[model samples]
Target chain A: MSGPAYTPTDEELAHLQKLSSEFEPEVTGPLVGERQSSSAITTEYANADPVYRVKTAALPSKYSHYRTCRGDGHCGWRAIAFTYFEALLRLGDRNRFLEEETRLRSMGNLLNSIGFQEHLYEDFADECFDLLRKTESLVSAGNDERAAAELLASFNDVGVSMAIITYFKLLTSAWIQTHPNDFAPFLDLGQDIRQYCSTQIEPSVCEIDHVGMSALAEVLVKQAGFALEVLYLDRSAGEEINTYRFDPVSNDGLPLHNPPTLRLLYRPGHYDILYKMEDVQQPAIPQAPLHVALADYADEFVPMPTSRGMSDVMSLIPGMYPTGLGQNWPSVSYDYNPSPIPQPQMAAVPTYTSVPVPTTSQEYVNTAHHNVPLESPVGMSLNPPMTIERGGPFRPSMYELEPGFQSNHSQSLPFQTSIFRNSHYNTAHFLNPDFQPEEWSPDSEYVTGSRSRHKSASQ
Target chain B: MSSSRSQTPTKRLLNELQTYQSDPNDALVELGPVSDNELTHWTAVMKGVPGTAYEGGRWKLDIRIPSNYPNAPPEVKFVTRICHPNVNFKTGEICLDLLKTSWSPAYTITTTLTSIQQLLTSAEPDSPLNVDIAQLFRLGDFVGAEALIRYYTESERWEGRQSV
Candidate 1:
C-alpha cells in the first residue's frame, strides 16, 4: 500500500472544519423560507461574515432588497417556484393565474412520456394547482397583501412545497430525456444525460448547476414567461456578483420581452430572491427631490416626445422648483420610478448619469401602494403631487416642448453611482457616453444567449 | 412541517392503494397496506410466470416505505423466502439496481414490484447475491438450480399455509 498513507496534522484546519461542521444545517423541515423584508437581509448578514458583508453591501445598490431563502438543497427550485407564484399574485390577474394552472397541469404529458404514471406526479401538481386557485380567490377579493402572505405561508408548508419542488425536478428531468440530443453534447461529466439528471439534478436536496437551471428555465420561461436573473456571488475577484439571465425564447425564436420578474442572489451553495426597493416603496415622503438634480441630468438628454417625457417633465417641474412657487411636491421620487404603464426607454439615454438616492425610513411602506393611479385623469385637483398621481397617460401634451422631461425611469441608466466606489457598473458605458445601446438593445437582448453559449463552449 | 412531511408519503401511499384497488392486476399481483391505518407498510403478493422455472410459485414481499416515501425508495424484501441468484435466500434482500441508486420518484410500488417480477425471469448472474446459486447457473447447472428453486417455493408455500 505504498507504506502508510501520507497524512498531515493540520490543527488549525481540523479546528476550522469542526467549527464549520457545527453549522451544517440539518434538513428536517420543508424547503422554503418565510418572505423577509429585503432590508432584513442586510441587518441579518452585513456584519457577521465578511463574505456575506461583501454580498449584502453590494446587493442593496442593484437590488435594494432581498428575501433570504432557507439554505436547503432545494433552494434554487423553491426560490424560483415561490417567485413564480408571487409574480402572478403581484400582477393580480386571476385569468393569468388560471392559464398558468392549466399549463402546469399539462406538463404531466412530459412526465408521462418519460414513463411516470399520472398518480406519481398528480398529487404534487395538484398541490401547485390548489395554491394557484386559492391565491386567485384571495387576489380577486382585493387582498393582494393577504394573497402574498398566504402564498409564502403555503411555501413554508412542507407537503405543498416539496410537491412543487418534486414536480419541478421531474419536469426538468423529463426535458433532458425528451430532448436528449439537445442535452447530450453537454453531458460531459462522463455520465449520460439521464444519469446526470437523476443522480445530480432531480433529487430533492441536490443543488442545481448551469445545465439544471437552464433546463428548468426552458420549461418554465417558455410556459410562464417569467424572466429570471441569478447574480452569482462567489469568491471570484470581483466587487460585483456575476449575473446570469435565463429567458427562454418563443417558438418563433423571438425572445420574450418580459423584464426579469425574478432576481436571485446565488451564493456558492444557495439561492434567494432580490427585490428592487424602488419598485417596493409606497409614495409617502416629504417632497424634497433631494437628489433630483443629479438624476435630472437624464432630463437634458431627452431625445423624443413620449408619455414618459410628459410624466418626467411633470414630475420634474415640482422638483425643479420645490420652494420657488407655493407648490408642495411631496417627495415624488416614488412616482419617479414606478410607472404603471410600460414606457419607452427614457432610462437608457446616453447623456444621463445615474445617482443612487439613499432610501429614507418612510419608503418602507408596503408595495400595496403600487396600484394607486399615477395621476388623476381630470386634472381638477391642481395639486402638483396629486396631479402626478392622476396623470394616467401622456395625452398629447403641449408640455412635450419642455426639454428636461424626455427621459423616463426606463431610460435611467442601470449604472447608479454607488456610495461604495468599488461598486462599478460592469458595463463599458459607465464611463463612456458614446456607448451605442442600439448596437445591442441592452434591455431586450437578455443575457440568456451569451450564458447558454458559454455553457455550450464549456461543454 | 412534520405533519406535512408525513402527509405526503401517506397521501401518495393512499393514492397508489386506490389505483391498485380500482384496477386490480388479478392474475399477476395483489397489493395493499398491512393495516387500514398504516400506509407506509404494505404487502405485495405476486404469482410466478406460467412457463418460467418459477411456475406455480407464490411470493409475498414486505414493502416498508419511509416517511419520505416517493423521494426515497421503499424497503422491499421477500417475506416468502425463495432461491434465486440475485436474491439472498436467507434475508430475501434483492440485488436489483432499481431498488438501489437508480430509484426515481416516478417508480411507484406497482412499478417496483413489476420490475422485481422481471428480475425473476432474467436474473443478472454476474452481480449475484447468492454466489452458490450464481455459480451453479454459470456452470450450466440449470436443472440443479431449477429443482432447488421449485422445492424452496413449495416449502415456502406450505409454510405459509401452516402459519395461516
Candidate 2:
C-alpha cells in the first residue's frame, strides 16, 4: 500500500527466505517488479509472528481449559507451540509478554496435570533454549552503537526455526506421552490446531487424549505469542503474509506423528476467523461485509493462523499470518466454535421484516405455477406513483413462502436450531408462559433474535 | 470374562442389548454386528424416509459402543456413501452436537441411531458438515440431490460396500 509496489532484492529475499519453514516457497528469483521505498521492515524472523496480549476473564472460564487436542484414539492430534521470539522487536508492551509467560506457565501446568511425562518433551525444550537466548541477545542489541545487532540479526533465522521446531517437538512429545496407549494409532494424525480426525475410539482413551491436547494447545498459544511480539515491533509484520491463506505446516517440520494442519486466524478484535485447511495451497482473504468495517474495535486479538504453512511464511517475512497471532499474547478472548447459534427448526422460521416476501400474487407451489401478481391499474395514488415492477427484465423477486418450505436465502451468520429448544425453560425470559415445565424440550420459543421477534410480532 | 458370556455382538444384542438396538423387526431396517467377535460393534440399515428423494434408499452405518455403557454414548459413523449435511467430506465425521459436548447420559444408542436416521431424512444443508453439500444445496442443484439418493438406495450399500 505504500507508494508503488516494491519487490525485495534477490539477496534480501534469499536472506528472508531462509527463515521460512521448508514448505513455504522461497522468493529467491530476480525481482520481476520494480521497487520503491517500502516501509523499513524487521528482520524476517523478528516479525515472524504478531504478539498477542492475554485477555482472560477475571474468574476462570468454565470451559477455560484450552487443549492442543491430540486425538490419539481417532488419532487426530494438533500441536501448539508457544514460541517467544524476542530477538528483533524490543516489545514496549510489557503486559503482552507477561500475559504470554503466564499462559506458558499455565500450559506447562496443564501438561503436568494431565499425567504427561516431561521426559518426552526434552528434545523440543533443548532446541528451544538456544533460540530463545539468541532472541534475547538480538533484542538487547537492536540498532545499537556496535555491529552486535547485525550479528544477532544474522543468527535470528536459524535461532527462530530452532525455537519453533523444538517447541513443536515438546508439544507433540508431551501429547503422545499422555496418550501412550493411543499414541501409535495417531501416528498418521497431522498435528496442528483445528484438525478433526474421526476415529470411533474408546471414551476413556479419548478423554485422556483430550487432556494431552489441552496441554499442547497451551504451548501453541505461547509460540504464537512470540510471533505476535515481532508484529508489535513493526507494522511491516502485516506486509509479509498475503491475505490468501494456505496449509499450516508439513509433517516433518512439526514433529510427533503429524503436521499442524488447521490454521484459524482472527482479524484483530475477533471480527473474523480465517480457517486454513491443510493441503490447500492458498486461500483467498475472506472479504468482510462493509458493516464489519463499522463495528467498534475491541482490545482483542483473535486466534492467529497456527498452521505449518502460515508459520512457514512467517519464517520469511515475519509478522505475517501466523506470526501476527502469537499465543498467550492475549487480546479479547473468544470461543473456539465462534460459530453462530444453529438455526432451530421451530414451528415458524424467523421472519425478518425486510427479507423480501413474495407478494401473495406471485406465490406459487412450483415454477410452472408462477402467476405474476401485477396489479391491473388498481386504485390511483394521491401523487403520480413511480412504476414498481413493470415486468422488466428482472425475473420474479423470490419472496414466496410455501408452507414448510425453507427460504432460499443466504444469511450473514449461522442460525442456531437450538433456539427452538424448549430445554432452556429454566430462564424466565426464554421460557414460554404456557409451558412452564422443568424439563428441557425441543419445542421452545424460537431462539430469541430479531428475526424471530419480527415473526411473532407480525402475528 | 466368563465362557458363558455372549461375546457375539449380534447374540448379546438380541438379548441383553435389546433396548439399544434399532427396530430389528422391520424388514426395511436391519441391526446386528459388523463382525462376529466384536460385541461392541454393530451394523445398521436405515431405509430412506418416505416423501424425500431417498424414499427407496438404504444407508449403512458402523457403530462402535464404548465399554462405559450408558454412562457415555457410542460412536456412530456412516459406512455407506450416503450424502448428507452433518457428515464430513472425505470421512464420515458427523457434526451433530449430541455426539460431541452436547451429549447427555440419557441418550441411548437406539436414540442416537434414530437421531441419525432423522438427520438423513431431513438433511439440513445450512449447518452442513461437508461444505460441498452445503454449496450444492445453496445453489439449488436438485440433480446432485437425486444422485446422492441413488447412491444410498443402491443394494451394494446394504452389503457394506465402501466408496471413495
Candidate 3:
C-alpha cells in the first residue's frame, strides 16, 4: 500500500516526465551526407503532399545540388557550419582561408567579453580553428577535391562536427549578448538575452531558430563577406519556396555585388545545404593544360602566308601596318603592341601567321609550298568572315587560330588587355582554377614601360 | 578509429583535471578520475552550499563521461542520499536541466559540481524527483523539509565514503 492515495497519479506523472526527457527521435544517416543532385529531393517528395511535390520538383532547376545534414536535432547548426566551409572551398582561394582563420581567432575576444571562460570554450574553438588551418593547407596544396573530402569527413565525425556546432552556438550566443538591441525585440517580452541564449542557443541539443540564425549569420557569415540564404519549403500557400537572404555589406553599407554565399534548404525543423550550378564548378587547373596543347598543335600545322595580294589589301586599312607600307611587314607583325590603334593589325598578323592559308587563287597555288593539307570544308565555311571582321586581309581559313594563339600570346603579354584581365580565362580571375588575386607591385608599375602600355591598352 | 574517437574526450578530461588541480573550486572537496587507467569514470566530493539546509554535509557524486566528452555531457548522480526536491532520495538521480538538455561543452566537471552545489540551495520543487520533499516545499513546510534534509545529510554522509 502506498503512503498517500495521490501517490499513484504522481508516480505516473513522474514516469511520463522521465520518458519525455529521455526520448530521442530516431535519426539515421551520416552526420553530414555527401553532396548529391538535388533532383533526389524531388524524387523523395514525389509521393508526398502536392505542395511539397511541386516545390521539390522546381528545386533542382534553381538549386542544382544539395547535401543532407542528418535529421538529428543539430541539423540546422550543422548545415550552416558545413556550407560555410564549403563556400570557402568553392572560392578556391588560399588566402581567403587564412583570412577566415584570423577572423575567427580574433572572435575569441568576443567569447571572453561575454563571460565565456576561455579555457572551457577554447577546446571547441580549437577544433574549429584546427579544421580551418587543415583546410587552408589542403587548399594551398591545390588539392581541392581532397580538401573537400577532408572537410566532409571532419563534419561527419560526430565529435569534431559537434564541437564545431557548439563553438558556433557559443559565438551566436556571444553575438546576441553583445548586440542586444538588434535581437532583444525578437525575444519574448522582458526575456533576458542571456537566459534566451542558455535555453535556445548554447544547448547542444537545441535546433537553431530564426533569431539564432540571424545572429549566426551576422557574426559568422556576413562579417566574413559571405551571404546566407535560406529557402523555406513549407506548405504556406505558395507554389515556390520562400527565400530569406542575408547579404553581406561593405563598410560603406552597400551590399556586396556577389559575395560567396552559404545556402540552406529548410523543411520545417530540418536543414540541408543547397548549391547552385556555379557553386560546383571544378577549379580551372585542368583546362589550362588542354589549351596549351591546342596552341602547340596550331603552331605546328598553320602556314605563314606571304601572299602579296593579302599584304596589298592589309595596307589599305587606316591603322594597319602603323610603321608605314612595305617596311618589313613581318617585322611589323612581331611588334606585339596591344594599343587600340594596332589591335586590328595585331589581330591580322596572328590570323595570317597562325591560320592555315585560305583557298585563294594566289595562296591556293602556293599552299603546296607550306606542305600542310588544305582546309576542310567546315573550317573553310567558318573562317573567312571571322578573319574579315577581325580586320585580316585574307579570307579566314576554316582553322580558327584564337584558341592556340591567345594561349601563346598570353605568355608574352601576361596581362593582355583590360578585357582579357577581366575575363574568367585569366589566372587572376576568381573563377579560374589557379585563382591568385592580382597584387599591385611597385616595381612593375614604375620600372616597366610595357606595363604602362598594357595599362593604356586596357583603357 | 576507436582510439581517435576516444582521443578528444580523453584529452579534454585531462585538461579539466589539470585545470581543477591548479585551481580547485571552493565548493568541490575532491574531483578526478576514479582510477589511473580509467579517465571516463570519475568521482567527485562536493560540499553543500554554505547557507543551505544541507550545509556541513559532503555529497559524493559518480560521474560517467562518454567518449565524446565535452560534446556530450557527462552523466552525474549523487552517491550519497540527499533530501532535495530536485534529487531522488531512493536513487541518486538529479533533475537539474544543466545536467541534461541545457548542458554545453563549455561546462567542466568542476563547474558542473559547482552548479550542483548551487542547485542544493535553490531546489526546483515544481519538477521534483523526490515528490514528498517537493510537496513539503510546495506546501511551505520549510521547517519539516529542513529537518528531513538535515537528518539524511547527517545519516547518509558516510554511506559511500569507504568505497571512495
Identify the leading candidate in terms of DockQ.
Answer: 3
TM-score of each: 0.61, 0.25, 0.69
lDDT of 1 by residue, A209-316 (tens): 878888887776445656677888776764445777775343344444322257788877888887654334332442211111111123222221223233333322
lDDT tens per residue, model 2, B1-164: 11211122233244435543423433237676667677788877777677776676666777887654333457888776666767874576776756764443334455577777777666778878777767778889978966765564564355544332
Q: After superposition, how far is residue A100 of candidate 3 from its true place, in Å?
A: 0.8
Separately for all candidates shown, the number of backbone clashes (residues 3 or more apart, or on different chains) is 14, 66, 3
The prediction achieving the highest lDDT against the true structure is: 3
- Docking class for candidate 2: incorrect
Ranking by DockQ: 3, 1, 2
Off by over 4 Å in 1: A1-25, A28-30, A37-56, A189-207, A248-252, A258-260, A278-459, B1-14, B21-28, B35-39, B47-58, B66-68, B82-90, B93-103, B118-164
Instruction: Report the lDDT tens digits of candidate 1 across residue range B95-118.
Output: 886776567677788878888888
The best-first sequence of candidates by lDDT reads: 3, 1, 2
Please list, in the order the candidates appear, how each scores on TM-score for chain B only.
Answer: 0.89, 0.71, 0.92
For each candidate, the alpha-carbon lDDT, in order, equals: 0.64, 0.37, 0.72
Q: Candidate 2 recovers what fraction of true contacts?
A: 0.00
DockQ score for model 3, please?
A: 0.32
- Interface RMSD (Å), each candidate? 3.7, 21.6, 3.1
Ranking of candidates on TM-score, top first: 3, 1, 2
The sequence of per-residue lDDT tens digits that candidate 2 reaches over residues A1-459 is 655788888988877775662343333321111111111121223334442111111001111111121122211221122212221122423333334434444456445554333432333344344434444444454432222333233223333333333344344444445555554445446643212212211121232233334334433432332211111122333222223222212122222111222332222211111112111222122211111111123323322232222223222211111211112121111111111221121112322221122221111111111222223233322111111233323342332212111222222124434554535432222555543323443333334356689899999
Here the TM-score of candidate 1's chain B is: 0.89
